[model samples]
Target: MHKEVTIYDIAEKLSISASTVSRALNANSLVSKKTQQKIIAMATSMGYRSNTFAANLRMQRSNTIGLIVPRLNSYFMSEVISGIESVTNDAGYNLIISQSMENVDKEISNLKTMFNNRVDGLLVSVAAGSNGLTGFDIFRDRKIPVLFFDRAPHGLTVPSVTIDNENAAFLITQHLIEMGAKNIFHITGHQSVSVYKERTSGFKRALLAAGLPFNENQLIVTDLSEKAGIAAAKLIAELKGDGVFAANDSCAATCMNELKLQGFKIPQDVKFAGFNNDLISRNIDPALTTINYPGFEMGKVIAAKLLDHLSHKSDLHSSPLITMKSELVIRASSNYKP
Candidate 1:
């Protein structure tokens, strides 16, 4: 039977104390660079495997960050996960990711599991129907850092990283107006979500600022899915709105396709735009006008900021907010020239 190799075996082989091997393995500053290399080489050759669970217990930290998002099915979230994992892996941290599917009950349950696992930090993009977070007090009591991103809850003291949704929506709507669109409609997700709520506000603000007609009926709320997009397109066809701004590219792309099937000439009979600069935005028939949301960058910032708070000292933002920059990309879908 083969015996499990331990750090003690490596230390005895190198004629050094186990403490020195431990320090070298953890990359302690006290260990010389040349000695660390030797130790690592010997450890690797000897088939030494680290017991991370035991090491974490000794350090009183799990080196794990819990991430909760509304859903992971979107391209935006995929980019975010890629960026976050890159930083976390480099920093020797692991991630425990969960999706809430926009369900408040599931979100609360996810929070409980994270807390039980004793994660060192947490990142969240809140679910719909969760306007506020109350189950986070346990994490707060334990001194675990929690950062919100993209879809932060309302009235929470937790620091958040996101783009200016209100302003972005305003810019998109204003661009439609500039394109000679007299009647504009903003198709979005659950009105309760902060991003959607802010976008609706921006849409109204742009309409009011442009001296155009503003009413609640112009704000079409949906699940922001492909089916929702088709339904919204039908509604827009009946309403005869000259401009349509969906909250995401998927909805906007599908809706635009449906509109084209309905015999409407894009940018002529009905100008359209979307958000998130997703791949679909550029591949469609006429291409979609959209806002270039930096999902990957946002993820990096969220992870880095939390890591900064965890390592050496606390470096949290005093304002509890980090607003990322987003830009509008005009395309054939909305760039109408009279």
Candidate 2:
């Protein structure tokens, strides 16, 4: 049977006292930094592993953070998580990730689990329902730092990292208007989510600014899926709208395909645009016009903020919102000059 390597073995190999080795391993200030580095190197060469359980017990910290997101399947969501992992891993921390699957009940349950695990901090992208954050009070009471990103909940003054959704939406709508599209239809996800609500507001602001009627009939809300895109295209065909702005690239791409099948020409018959510069947006016929949302950057910002709070380097109360930048990417789909 193989035996586990210990600090005492490392000390014996280095001809040093076990107490000195222990102090070096724990990064005690009493141990000189140079000696600590040498001891660490020797420990690594000797295949010694520190007892994290004991270390954590002494420090009263888990060295772990909890992350909750609406879903993990999308490219945007996955990239955000990857960015977070990159930052946390370099900082000697681990992430415990959970997906709410856009269900309020599941989100509440995940929150409970995070609390039970005694995570050092929490990062969240809220789910779609109004009751998605029923468990938020517990974290507040426990004095745990919670930072939200992307689909943050409204009315919660918790520090968050997000882009100006309303501004981005307004830009896209205005671009379609500038392209000589008079009747523009807007397709989006559930308005309960803050991102969708802000986007809807932006769309309305643009239409009203252009002296166009705010037609409720032209707004379609769905799950932002490919199926939703198909349905939205069918509705637009019936309404005979000149342009469309779907909330996501998947829906936008699928909507374009559906519109083409229905004998509509891209940008010629009906101009199309979407949000989130997803790969599907670029790969589609007449690449989609979209807003380049900085998902990965948002993730890095949120992780940095949470880590700063944990390290006492920043105060969450001072800044309630950390806004990232997003830009409009014009493509062939919305550039037809005819």
Query: lDDT for every model?
Result: 0.89, 0.88
Residue 207 in candidate 2, Cα distance off native in Å: 0.8
lDDT of 2 at 76: 92
Each candidate: RMSD to true structure?
Answer: 5.9, 5.9
Clashes of 1: 0
lDDT of 1: 0.89
lDDT of 2 by residue, 184-242 (tens): 99898898999999999999999999999987987899999889999888899999999
Model 2 spans > 4 angstroms off:
1-52, 131-133
Q: List the residue pairs that clash in candidate 1.
A: none
Model 2 lDDT, residue 114, Cα: 92
